[model samples]
Target: MRTAAYVLVRHELRLLASLAMWLARRTHGAGGGRVFGYARGQGAMMFGFAFVCLVETLTMSVLLRDYPTVHQMVFVLDVYTIVFVVGVHAACVVRPHVLDPDVLRIRRAVHVDLRLPVDRIAAVRRELRTTHEHADGELDIPVGAQTTVTVELAEPVAHFGFFGRRRDIHLVRFHADDADSLVQALGQALAGAVTQARSAPSPRPDLPA
Candidate 1:
């Protein structure tokens, strides 16, 4: 019970923070990094769903007008539902995938956020996959009904779930609005990371680029 409450509180906090970021037209962590957005595919769907909720709220407000106590309670719940739905979309908008010089950060709303070291990435490609199969060591973060990018890592990376569950992932598939550009940028970053790793002396570490 306590764990569930904590997760709920954490999720609400993330949504509120996301709402602020969305209102400010700012991304969460894209400073000094390339931002790749996956939210475009789901933007229409999310708003459409919110519209449906708005309609239902209106309908319920009229039907429950006879019972003052129940009407007030239902009205509050309906408004909260609308806020929650919109906040989820806002979270997706603000928390985009980020690619630094040495790490590639992939995210989906307030849930998945996995950072893979550039050196550990074996291959990255622009493969549009609408269907995915769940397998051990594979993590798929699909946007809408499809994924536009596929990444295979040379080694496994740890991924933590919303409930604090942990798993080791060797393959990751996700969506990006401009997948070709993301793939190209990742290829260049990987090459640079590899070159730097090879030239660095074992006893002395190279400075952060």
Candidate 2:
């Protein structure tokens, strides 16, 4: 009996892990999977751009004798320089979002078993809106096959509705997300776990992302 019980426990853990892995992959979506590829493409384009800019600048410098228009050249160079800087900055921010070491990586990952325990639950921060006296936020709510929820928070307002304004309350805030199904499932599971932790006897530990 003891040997059989041990074997069963190992098998169950393996099954659960497999399910969790599946869910993680499913939730990541095709865009997430191609993050690395996107980053590589962007890097290549930037390199090519830099090479062309260098050649153009050098050629223009040599041709200064023929078209000695200093002001126009300065203006063109200034605009091009700004564009290059902005492009590089954008690439840096997007690189992490598509790479493995992304800062916004999931905090916890677990199997789809709703009965699983929850230790720490952090609110998803979709879009953060701030004001002098109060702060508001919005969550990406997928309405259906092609709908979405966009909420705006207002301070000192009784509720965070569409008409909420910046003034009136000392402070106010709201939040939302686009991952409706996963978030809803996670919420229900966490709520149940919280209830169980209070009444039932069990050890609920935090899961790794």
Candidate 3:
């Protein structure tokens, strides 16, 4: 119960922070690293859902006028529901996938944040996959029911779920607004990392007197 409450409170705070970031027209923790956003595909759908919620709110306000207590309670819930719907999208907008030189940060809203070391990435390509099986070592983060970029790791990386469940991920598939660009950038970053590793000079053996 304590863990559940903590998770709930943390989610609410994250939503509020996301809304603030959205209003401020800034992203979260995307400095120096290249940001790849996956929020574009769901914007229209989320707004449409919010519009439907608004309609329901107005309809309820008229229908429940006689019951003062009931109307007040319903009204509060309606407004909060609308905000929650919009806040989910805002979270996605603010927290995008970040690709740094050393780590590839993959995130989905407030739930999933998996950082894979660049050296562990074996291959990355632009592959649109709509169907995914429930696998033990694969993690799929799809936007609008489709994944655009696929990443295969040389070694498994540890991912902890929202409820503190650990999973070893050897394959990662996710969506990005500009899939090609993200794939290209990540490939280049991986290549650069490899080249730097190879080109690094080894320390000379100590010469004995």
Q: Give the per-residue lDDT digits (tens) of candidate 2, residues 111-175.
A: 11111113433332233333223233322211111112122222222322222222232221222
Question: Which is the better candidate, 1 or 3, if ranked by TM-score?
Answer: 3
Which scores better on lDDT, 2 or 3? 3
Candidate 2 structure, TM-score to reference: 0.27
Q: Model 1, 155: alpha-carbon shift in Å?
A: 0.9
Off-target runs (Cα >4 Å) in candidate 1 are 201-209
> Candidate 3, after superposition: displacement of residue 150 in Å?
0.6
Q: For residue 39, what is the lDDT in candidate 3? A: 95
Q: Which parts of model 2 are misplaced by more than 4 Å?
A: 1-38, 71-95, 98-209
Kindly list the per-residue Cα lDDT of model 3 for residues 92-177, writing each as its tens digit.
99999999999999988888889999999999999999998879899999888999999999999999888888899999999999
Clashing residue pairs in all predictions, respectively, total: 0, 4, 0
| Residue-level lDDT for 108 in candidate 3 | 85
Cα lDDT of model 1 by residue, 1-209, tens digit = 34978998999889988988899998898879999988888989988988998998899889999998998999899888888888988999899999999899999999888999998999999999999998999998998989999999999999988888889999999999999999999999998988898998888688899
